[model samples]
Target: MNILFDVGASGGALLHNASEMDIDLRNVDVIVISHGHYDHTGGLLDALKIINKPTAIIIHPDALALKYAIKPKFRLTGVPHTISEIKKHGGRFLVTHDSVFLTDSVATTGEIKRETDFEKTPEYYMLIRGGKVAQDKLLDDQALVINHEKGLIVITGCAHAGVVNTIRHAQKIFGRRDVYAVIGGFHLIGASDERIEKTVESLIEINPRIVGPCHCTGDKALKIISDNFAGKFTEVRVGTVLNL
Candidate 1:
Protein backbone atom coordinates (compact mmCIF):
# COMPACT_ATOMS: atom_id res chain seq x y z
CA MET A 1 0.00 0.00 0.00
CA ASN A 2 1.25 3.51 -0.79
CA ILE A 3 1.53 5.72 2.29
CA LEU A 4 2.61 9.35 2.59
CA PHE A 5 4.37 10.08 5.85
CA ASP A 6 3.97 13.83 5.65
CA VAL A 7 3.12 16.25 2.86
CA GLY A 8 5.67 19.01 2.35
CA ALA A 9 5.02 22.77 2.88
CA SER A 10 3.35 22.97 -0.50
CA GLY A 11 0.80 20.23 -1.26
CA GLY A 12 0.29 21.19 -4.90
CA ALA A 13 4.01 21.35 -5.59
CA LEU A 14 4.61 18.03 -3.90
CA LEU A 15 1.86 16.44 -5.99
CA HIS A 16 3.36 17.97 -9.14
CA ASN A 17 6.79 16.58 -8.33
CA ALA A 18 5.34 13.17 -7.47
CA SER A 19 3.56 13.12 -10.80
CA GLU A 20 6.83 13.88 -12.55
CA MET A 21 8.22 10.77 -10.90
CA ASP A 22 5.12 8.80 -11.97
CA ILE A 23 3.77 8.53 -8.41
CA ASP A 24 -0.03 8.67 -8.39
CA LEU A 25 -1.30 10.69 -5.40
CA ARG A 26 -4.67 8.94 -5.58
CA ASN A 27 -2.95 5.71 -4.63
CA VAL A 28 -2.08 7.06 -1.20
CA ASP A 29 -4.01 5.14 1.47
CA VAL A 30 -2.71 6.83 4.58
CA ILE A 31 -1.39 10.28 5.53
CA VAL A 32 0.57 10.57 8.78
CA ILE A 33 1.26 13.95 10.29
CA SER A 34 4.35 13.89 12.56
CA HIS A 35 3.41 17.03 14.42
CA GLY A 36 1.23 20.13 14.32
CA HIS A 37 3.91 22.37 12.85
CA TYR A 38 2.96 24.25 9.68
CA ASP A 39 5.99 23.10 7.71
CA HIS A 40 4.79 19.55 8.17
CA THR A 41 1.01 19.98 7.80
CA GLY A 42 0.82 22.94 5.43
CA GLY A 43 0.13 20.70 2.44
CA LEU A 44 -2.37 18.47 4.27
CA LEU A 45 -5.49 20.21 2.97
CA ASP A 46 -4.23 20.16 -0.59
CA ALA A 47 -3.22 16.54 -0.24
CA LEU A 48 -6.76 15.66 0.84
CA LYS A 49 -7.99 17.35 -2.30
CA ILE A 50 -5.67 15.39 -4.58
CA ILE A 51 -6.43 12.03 -3.00
CA ASN A 52 -10.19 12.48 -3.75
CA LYS A 53 -10.84 9.14 -2.06
CA PRO A 54 -11.29 8.42 1.61
CA THR A 55 -7.76 8.72 3.10
CA ALA A 56 -7.01 7.93 6.73
CA ILE A 57 -5.07 10.72 8.48
CA ILE A 58 -3.10 9.37 11.40
CA ILE A 59 -2.21 12.13 13.85
CA HIS A 60 -2.04 12.83 17.59
CA PRO A 61 -5.13 14.59 18.98
CA ASP A 62 -2.91 17.31 20.45
CA ALA A 63 -1.91 18.26 16.92
CA LEU A 64 -5.13 20.24 16.70
CA ALA A 65 -4.12 22.42 19.66
CA LEU A 66 -2.73 25.93 19.25
CA LYS A 67 1.06 25.94 19.27
CA TYR A 68 3.79 28.41 18.38
CA ALA A 69 7.52 29.11 18.55
CA ILE A 70 8.38 32.07 20.75
CA LYS A 71 12.04 32.34 19.99
CA PRO A 72 13.53 34.82 17.44
CA LYS A 73 9.99 36.27 17.14
CA PHE A 74 6.38 35.46 17.92
CA ARG A 75 4.53 33.71 15.11
CA LEU A 76 1.96 31.03 14.40
CA THR A 77 3.77 27.75 13.75
CA GLY A 78 1.05 25.14 14.24
CA VAL A 79 -0.92 23.33 11.55
CA PRO A 80 -2.31 25.91 9.16
CA HIS A 81 -5.40 23.89 8.22
CA THR A 82 -8.35 23.55 10.60
CA ILE A 83 -10.33 20.37 11.35
CA SER A 84 -13.27 21.71 9.39
CA GLU A 85 -11.00 22.38 6.45
CA ILE A 86 -9.60 18.88 6.60
CA LYS A 87 -13.11 17.39 6.59
CA LYS A 88 -14.08 19.72 3.77
CA HIS A 89 -11.31 18.14 1.69
CA GLY A 90 -12.56 14.62 2.47
CA GLY A 91 -9.84 13.71 4.97
CA ARG A 92 -10.76 11.18 7.63
CA PHE A 93 -9.04 11.93 10.91
CA LEU A 94 -7.92 9.01 13.02
CA VAL A 95 -6.85 11.06 15.99
CA THR A 96 -5.38 9.06 18.82
CA HIS A 97 -2.84 9.08 21.65
CA ASP A 98 -1.95 5.42 21.23
CA SER A 99 -0.17 3.52 18.50
CA VAL A 100 -2.40 3.04 15.42
CA PHE A 101 -1.85 0.36 12.80
CA LEU A 102 -2.58 1.66 9.32
CA THR A 103 -2.09 -1.78 7.87
CA ASP A 104 -0.62 -5.06 9.08
CA SER A 105 2.94 -3.78 8.62
CA VAL A 106 2.58 -0.03 9.15
CA ALA A 107 1.91 1.78 12.47
CA THR A 108 2.13 5.13 14.21
CA THR A 109 4.43 5.85 17.17
CA GLY A 110 1.64 7.72 19.04
CA GLU A 111 3.11 9.88 21.81
CA ILE A 112 6.79 9.19 22.30
CA LYS A 113 8.23 8.91 25.79
CA ARG A 114 10.78 11.58 26.69
CA GLU A 115 13.43 9.56 28.53
CA THR A 116 16.54 11.49 27.58
CA ASP A 117 17.40 14.30 29.96
CA PHE A 118 19.41 16.29 27.47
CA GLU A 119 16.95 15.99 24.59
CA LYS A 120 14.23 18.16 26.12
CA THR A 121 11.95 20.22 23.89
CA PRO A 122 13.11 23.78 23.55
CA GLU A 123 11.63 26.13 26.17
CA TYR A 124 10.91 28.75 23.53
CA TYR A 125 8.16 26.64 22.01
CA MET A 126 4.76 27.30 23.58
CA LEU A 127 1.05 26.52 23.47
CA ILE A 128 -1.17 29.56 23.49
CA ARG A 129 -4.53 29.49 25.27
CA GLY A 130 -6.75 32.46 26.01
CA GLY A 131 -3.79 34.77 25.39
CA LYS A 132 -1.81 32.83 28.00
CA VAL A 133 1.29 31.11 26.63
CA ALA A 134 2.68 28.02 28.32
CA GLN A 135 5.52 25.70 27.46
CA ASP A 136 4.57 23.44 24.57
CA LYS A 137 5.44 19.87 25.42
CA LEU A 138 4.80 18.94 21.79
CA LEU A 139 2.96 15.80 22.73
CA ASP A 140 1.58 15.78 19.21
CA ASP A 141 4.98 14.79 17.86
CA GLN A 142 4.96 11.23 16.52
CA ALA A 143 6.55 9.04 13.82
CA LEU A 144 5.60 6.34 11.31
CA VAL A 145 7.00 2.83 11.68
CA ILE A 146 7.10 0.45 8.74
CA ASN A 147 8.07 -3.15 9.37
CA HIS A 148 10.19 -4.37 6.48
CA GLU A 149 11.82 -7.71 5.77
CA LYS A 150 15.26 -6.65 6.96
CA GLY A 151 14.06 -4.56 9.89
CA LEU A 152 11.90 -1.58 10.86
CA ILE A 153 11.98 1.81 9.12
CA VAL A 154 11.05 4.88 11.20
CA ILE A 155 9.86 8.00 9.35
CA THR A 156 9.54 11.22 11.28
CA GLY A 157 8.40 14.79 10.61
CA CYS A 158 9.78 17.36 13.08
CA ALA A 159 10.75 15.09 15.96
CA HIS A 160 10.10 17.58 18.74
CA ALA A 161 9.65 14.76 21.24
CA GLY A 162 13.26 13.60 20.45
CA VAL A 163 14.47 11.31 17.65
CA VAL A 164 16.02 8.78 20.01
CA ASN A 165 12.79 8.64 21.95
CA THR A 166 10.84 8.14 18.74
CA ILE A 167 13.07 5.25 17.65
CA ARG A 168 12.88 3.61 21.06
CA HIS A 169 9.11 3.96 21.10
CA ALA A 170 8.92 2.39 17.65
CA GLN A 171 11.05 -0.51 18.77
CA LYS A 172 8.82 -1.12 21.78
CA ILE A 173 5.58 -0.81 19.83
CA PHE A 174 6.62 -3.07 16.95
CA GLY A 175 8.57 -5.47 19.18
CA ARG A 176 11.55 -5.15 16.82
CA ARG A 177 15.07 -4.28 17.83
CA ASP A 178 16.56 -3.97 14.36
CA VAL A 179 15.89 -0.51 12.97
CA TYR A 180 16.66 -0.63 9.25
CA ALA A 181 16.63 3.13 8.86
CA VAL A 182 15.42 6.45 10.32
CA ILE A 183 14.40 9.17 7.85
CA GLY A 184 13.27 12.80 8.29
CA GLY A 185 13.70 15.67 10.79
CA PHE A 186 15.57 15.29 14.06
CA HIS A 187 14.49 18.76 15.35
CA LEU A 188 17.96 19.75 16.49
CA ILE A 189 18.06 23.06 14.67
CA GLY A 190 19.45 25.06 17.62
CA ALA A 191 20.57 22.30 19.92
CA SER A 192 23.64 22.73 22.09
CA ASP A 193 26.94 20.93 21.45
CA GLU A 194 26.49 18.72 24.50
CA ARG A 195 22.96 17.80 23.48
CA ILE A 196 24.11 16.85 20.01
CA GLU A 197 26.93 14.72 21.38
CA LYS A 198 24.57 12.92 23.77
CA THR A 199 22.01 12.40 21.02
CA VAL A 200 24.65 10.84 18.76
CA GLU A 201 25.82 8.61 21.59
CA SER A 202 22.28 7.35 22.16
CA LEU A 203 21.81 6.79 18.43
CA ILE A 204 24.97 4.74 18.30
CA GLU A 205 23.61 2.47 21.01
CA ILE A 206 20.43 1.87 19.00
CA ASN A 207 22.29 1.83 15.74
CA PRO A 208 20.19 1.59 12.58
CA ARG A 209 21.31 0.49 9.13
CA ILE A 210 20.88 3.98 7.69
CA VAL A 211 20.10 7.52 8.89
CA GLY A 212 18.49 10.24 6.75
CA PRO A 213 18.35 13.58 8.54
CA CYS A 214 16.44 16.35 6.81
CA HIS A 215 14.19 19.42 7.35
CA CYS A 216 14.57 20.73 10.91
CA THR A 217 17.80 18.83 11.56
CA GLY A 218 20.52 21.46 11.97
CA ASP A 219 23.76 21.44 9.97
CA LYS A 220 25.90 20.81 13.05
CA ALA A 221 23.75 17.90 14.17
CA LEU A 222 23.72 16.44 10.65
CA LYS A 223 27.48 16.72 10.44
CA ILE A 224 27.88 15.07 13.81
CA ILE A 225 25.57 12.22 12.80
CA SER A 226 27.38 11.81 9.48
CA ASP A 227 30.74 11.76 11.19
CA ASN A 228 29.55 9.05 13.55
CA PHE A 229 27.45 6.94 11.14
CA ALA A 230 29.87 7.41 8.20
CA GLY A 231 28.68 5.45 5.12
CA LYS A 232 25.35 4.61 6.76
CA PHE A 233 24.09 8.19 6.46
CA THR A 234 21.99 9.18 3.43
CA GLU A 235 20.96 12.67 2.35
CA VAL A 236 17.16 13.01 2.33
CA ARG A 237 15.39 15.36 -0.08
CA VAL A 238 11.93 16.01 -1.55
CA GLY A 239 12.27 13.64 -4.53
CA THR A 240 14.30 11.00 -2.65
CA VAL A 241 12.60 7.60 -2.56
CA LEU A 242 13.65 4.49 -0.64
CA ASN A 243 12.68 1.13 -2.08
CA LEU A 244 12.29 -0.44 1.35
Candidate 2:
Protein backbone atom coordinates (compact mmCIF):
# COMPACT_ATOMS: atom_id res chain seq x y z
CA MET A 1 0.00 0.00 0.00
CA ASN A 2 1.37 3.38 -1.01
CA ILE A 3 0.99 6.10 1.62
CA LEU A 4 1.57 9.70 0.63
CA PHE A 5 2.97 11.56 3.62
CA ASP A 6 2.70 15.31 4.21
CA VAL A 7 2.28 17.20 0.90
CA GLY A 8 4.93 19.85 0.33
CA ALA A 9 4.50 23.63 0.48
CA SER A 10 2.27 23.56 -2.66
CA GLY A 11 0.53 21.18 -5.03
CA GLY A 12 2.42 22.31 -8.10
CA ALA A 13 5.74 20.97 -6.81
CA LEU A 14 4.25 17.73 -5.52
CA LEU A 15 2.42 17.11 -8.80
CA HIS A 16 5.49 17.85 -10.87
CA ASN A 17 7.68 15.54 -8.80
CA ALA A 18 5.10 12.76 -8.82
CA SER A 19 4.88 13.01 -12.56
CA GLU A 20 8.63 12.78 -12.87
CA MET A 21 8.63 9.71 -10.66
CA ASP A 22 5.68 8.21 -12.62
CA ILE A 23 3.58 8.08 -9.46
CA ASP A 24 -0.16 8.56 -9.98
CA LEU A 25 -1.69 10.62 -7.24
CA ARG A 26 -4.97 8.82 -7.87
CA ASN A 27 -3.32 5.54 -6.92
CA VAL A 28 -2.29 6.77 -3.50
CA ASP A 29 -4.28 4.72 -0.93
CA VAL A 30 -3.77 7.00 2.07
CA ILE A 31 -2.75 10.57 2.91
CA VAL A 32 -1.10 11.37 6.23
CA ILE A 33 -0.62 14.90 7.49
CA SER A 34 2.03 15.26 10.21
CA HIS A 35 0.75 18.56 11.50
CA GLY A 36 -1.32 21.62 10.62
CA HIS A 37 1.60 23.76 9.52
CA TYR A 38 1.17 25.55 6.18
CA ASP A 39 4.26 23.98 4.59
CA HIS A 40 2.87 20.51 5.23
CA THR A 41 -0.85 20.97 4.43
CA GLY A 42 -0.80 23.71 1.77
CA GLY A 43 -1.50 21.30 -1.11
CA LEU A 44 -4.35 19.35 0.45
CA LEU A 45 -7.01 20.96 -1.78
CA ASP A 46 -5.16 20.23 -5.01
CA ALA A 47 -4.22 16.70 -3.91
CA LEU A 48 -7.78 15.81 -2.98
CA LYS A 49 -8.92 17.03 -6.40
CA ILE A 50 -6.53 14.69 -8.24
CA ILE A 51 -6.89 11.47 -6.25
CA ASN A 52 -9.59 9.28 -7.83
CA LYS A 53 -10.25 6.83 -5.03
CA PRO A 54 -11.70 7.54 -1.58
CA THR A 55 -8.38 8.11 0.22
CA ALA A 56 -8.33 8.22 4.00
CA ILE A 57 -6.52 11.25 5.51
CA ILE A 58 -5.01 10.43 8.90
CA ILE A 59 -4.20 13.37 11.14
CA HIS A 60 -4.43 14.61 14.71
CA PRO A 61 -7.59 16.55 15.65
CA ASP A 62 -5.53 19.43 17.05
CA ALA A 63 -3.79 19.81 13.71
CA LEU A 64 -6.73 21.91 12.57
CA ALA A 65 -6.18 24.42 15.37
CA LEU A 66 -4.81 27.86 14.56
CA LYS A 67 -0.99 28.03 15.02
CA TYR A 68 1.55 30.80 14.55
CA ALA A 69 5.23 31.69 15.07
CA ILE A 70 5.71 34.95 16.98
CA LYS A 71 9.46 35.28 17.11
CA PRO A 72 10.46 37.15 13.94
CA LYS A 73 7.09 38.64 13.06
CA PHE A 74 3.35 38.14 13.35
CA ARG A 75 1.90 35.98 10.56
CA LEU A 76 -0.49 33.12 9.89
CA THR A 77 1.41 29.81 9.91
CA GLY A 78 -1.41 27.30 10.02
CA VAL A 79 -2.75 25.20 7.18
CA PRO A 80 -3.68 27.30 4.19
CA HIS A 81 -6.90 25.41 3.40
CA THR A 82 -9.84 25.01 5.76
CA ILE A 83 -11.62 21.73 6.60
CA SER A 84 -14.49 22.91 4.42
CA GLU A 85 -12.08 23.51 1.56
CA ILE A 86 -10.64 20.04 1.99
CA LYS A 87 -14.05 18.39 2.04
CA LYS A 88 -15.11 20.49 -0.94
CA HIS A 89 -12.29 18.78 -2.86
CA GLY A 90 -13.29 15.24 -1.74
CA GLY A 91 -10.83 14.90 1.09
CA ARG A 92 -11.92 12.46 3.82
CA PHE A 93 -10.35 13.11 7.20
CA LEU A 94 -9.95 10.53 9.97
CA VAL A 95 -8.91 12.82 12.76
CA THR A 96 -7.83 11.27 16.05
CA HIS A 97 -5.43 11.72 18.96
CA ASP A 98 -4.74 8.02 19.49
CA SER A 99 -2.25 5.94 17.57
CA VAL A 100 -3.81 4.74 14.29
CA PHE A 101 -2.75 1.57 12.53
CA LEU A 102 -2.91 2.39 8.84
CA THR A 103 -1.94 -1.14 7.87
CA ASP A 104 -0.60 -4.24 9.63
CA SER A 105 2.93 -2.93 9.26
CA VAL A 106 2.43 0.84 9.32
CA ALA A 107 1.14 3.07 12.15
CA THR A 108 1.00 6.68 13.26
CA THR A 109 2.93 7.83 16.32
CA GLY A 110 -0.15 9.77 17.45
CA GLU A 111 0.72 12.51 19.95
CA ILE A 112 4.38 12.14 20.86
CA LYS A 113 5.31 12.38 24.52
CA ARG A 114 7.76 15.18 25.30
CA GLU A 115 10.05 13.64 27.92
CA THR A 116 13.28 15.43 27.06
CA ASP A 117 14.09 18.69 28.78
CA PHE A 118 16.41 20.14 26.14
CA GLU A 119 14.03 19.50 23.24
CA LYS A 120 11.39 21.86 24.56
CA THR A 121 9.27 23.74 22.05
CA PRO A 122 10.47 27.24 21.34
CA GLU A 123 8.87 29.90 23.54
CA TYR A 124 8.33 32.19 20.56
CA TYR A 125 6.00 29.71 18.91
CA MET A 126 2.43 30.44 20.00
CA LEU A 127 -1.22 29.85 19.19
CA ILE A 128 -3.84 32.53 19.10
CA ARG A 129 -6.09 32.60 22.14
CA GLY A 130 -9.07 34.83 22.98
CA GLY A 131 -7.34 38.07 21.95
CA LYS A 132 -4.10 36.72 23.42
CA VAL A 133 -1.12 34.55 22.50
CA ALA A 134 -0.36 31.26 24.22
CA GLN A 135 2.67 29.01 23.86
CA ASP A 136 2.15 26.27 21.23
CA LYS A 137 3.40 22.98 22.61
CA LEU A 138 2.62 21.41 19.22
CA LEU A 139 0.84 18.45 20.67
CA ASP A 140 -0.46 17.77 17.17
CA ASP A 141 3.02 16.84 15.94
CA GLN A 142 3.36 13.15 15.06
CA ALA A 143 5.21 10.71 12.81
CA LEU A 144 4.65 7.56 10.70
CA VAL A 145 6.26 4.32 11.81
CA ILE A 146 6.80 1.53 9.27
CA ASN A 147 7.77 -1.76 10.80
CA HIS A 148 10.06 -3.24 8.19
CA GLU A 149 11.55 -6.73 8.48
CA LYS A 150 14.95 -5.34 9.41
CA GLY A 151 13.77 -2.64 11.79
CA LEU A 152 11.41 0.35 12.06
CA ILE A 153 11.42 3.30 9.66
CA VAL A 154 10.13 6.55 11.17
CA ILE A 155 8.98 9.41 8.96
CA THR A 156 8.10 12.85 10.26
CA GLY A 157 7.21 16.37 9.14
CA CYS A 158 8.88 19.22 11.05
CA ALA A 159 8.74 17.07 14.21
CA HIS A 160 7.55 19.95 16.36
CA ALA A 161 7.27 17.52 19.26
CA GLY A 162 11.04 16.88 19.19
CA VAL A 163 12.83 14.29 17.04
CA VAL A 164 14.30 12.34 19.94
CA ASN A 165 10.92 12.23 21.66
CA THR A 166 9.21 11.14 18.44
CA ILE A 167 11.72 8.34 17.88
CA ARG A 168 11.40 7.16 21.47
CA HIS A 169 7.61 7.13 21.15
CA ALA A 170 7.81 5.10 17.95
CA GLN A 171 10.13 2.58 19.57
CA LYS A 172 7.82 2.20 22.56
CA ILE A 173 4.72 1.85 20.41
CA PHE A 174 6.29 -0.74 18.12
CA GLY A 175 8.08 -2.55 20.97
CA ARG A 176 11.36 -2.41 19.10
CA ARG A 177 14.59 -0.49 19.59
CA ASP A 178 16.11 -1.14 16.18
CA VAL A 179 15.29 1.91 14.09
CA TYR A 180 16.16 1.20 10.45
CA ALA A 181 15.89 4.78 9.31
CA VAL A 182 14.50 8.20 10.30
CA ILE A 183 13.51 10.49 7.46
CA GLY A 184 12.23 14.08 7.67
CA GLY A 185 12.50 17.35 9.61
CA PHE A 186 14.22 17.55 12.98
CA HIS A 187 12.87 21.11 13.67
CA LEU A 188 16.19 22.20 15.21
CA ILE A 189 16.45 25.50 13.43
CA GLY A 190 17.58 28.36 15.72
CA ALA A 191 18.10 25.95 18.60
CA SER A 192 20.74 26.59 21.23
CA ASP A 193 24.12 24.80 21.06
CA GLU A 194 23.44 22.87 24.24
CA ARG A 195 20.08 21.69 22.97
CA ILE A 196 21.59 20.61 19.67
CA GLU A 197 24.30 18.66 21.45
CA LYS A 198 21.76 16.95 23.65
CA THR A 199 19.61 16.08 20.65
CA VAL A 200 22.56 14.56 18.82
CA GLU A 201 23.50 12.57 21.90
CA SER A 202 20.00 11.18 22.15
CA LEU A 203 19.99 10.27 18.47
CA ILE A 204 23.28 8.48 18.83
CA GLU A 205 21.89 6.40 21.66
CA ILE A 206 19.00 5.25 19.48
CA ASN A 207 21.47 4.56 16.62
CA PRO A 208 19.29 4.22 13.57
CA ARG A 209 20.80 2.58 10.48
CA ILE A 210 20.27 5.73 8.45
CA VAL A 211 19.26 9.35 9.09
CA GLY A 212 17.70 11.61 6.48
CA PRO A 213 17.11 15.12 7.76
CA CYS A 214 15.14 17.57 5.69
CA HIS A 215 13.12 20.83 5.70
CA CYS A 216 13.38 22.66 9.02
CA THR A 217 16.49 20.80 10.25
CA GLY A 218 18.91 23.71 10.44
CA ASP A 219 22.30 23.81 8.68
CA LYS A 220 24.28 23.78 11.91
CA ALA A 221 22.49 20.77 13.32
CA LEU A 222 22.55 18.98 9.96
CA LYS A 223 26.29 19.41 9.71
CA ILE A 224 26.78 18.25 13.26
CA ILE A 225 24.62 15.17 12.70
CA SER A 226 26.21 14.43 9.37
CA ASP A 227 29.67 14.71 10.84
CA ASN A 228 28.87 12.57 13.83
CA PHE A 229 26.79 10.00 11.99
CA ALA A 230 29.24 10.05 9.06
CA GLY A 231 28.24 7.60 6.31
CA LYS A 232 24.85 6.98 7.88
CA PHE A 233 23.48 10.50 7.30
CA THR A 234 21.58 11.14 4.08
CA GLU A 235 20.15 14.45 2.93
CA VAL A 236 16.47 14.29 1.98
CA ARG A 237 14.68 16.62 -0.45
CA VAL A 238 11.32 16.93 -2.28
CA GLY A 239 11.99 14.22 -4.87
CA THR A 240 14.09 11.94 -2.69
CA VAL A 241 12.71 8.43 -2.15
CA LEU A 242 13.63 5.93 0.56
CA ASN A 243 13.50 2.29 -0.51
CA LEU A 244 12.31 0.13 2.39
Candidate closest to the true structure, highest TM-score:
2
Candidate 1 lDDT, tens digit per residue, 53-138? 87889888778888878778998888898788898888899989999988889988899998889878878888866677788899
Query: How far does residue 241 in candidate 1 sit from its true spot (Å)?
Result: 1.7
Task: Give per-candidate clash totals.
Answer: 0, 0
After superposing candidate 2, which stretches have Cα over 4 Å from the reference?
A: 128-133
With candidate 2 superimposed using the best TM-score fit, by how many Å does residue 15's alpha carbon deviate from the native? 1.1
Q: State the local distance difference test value for candidate 1.
A: 0.87
Which ranges of candidate 1 are over 4 A from the true structure?
129-133
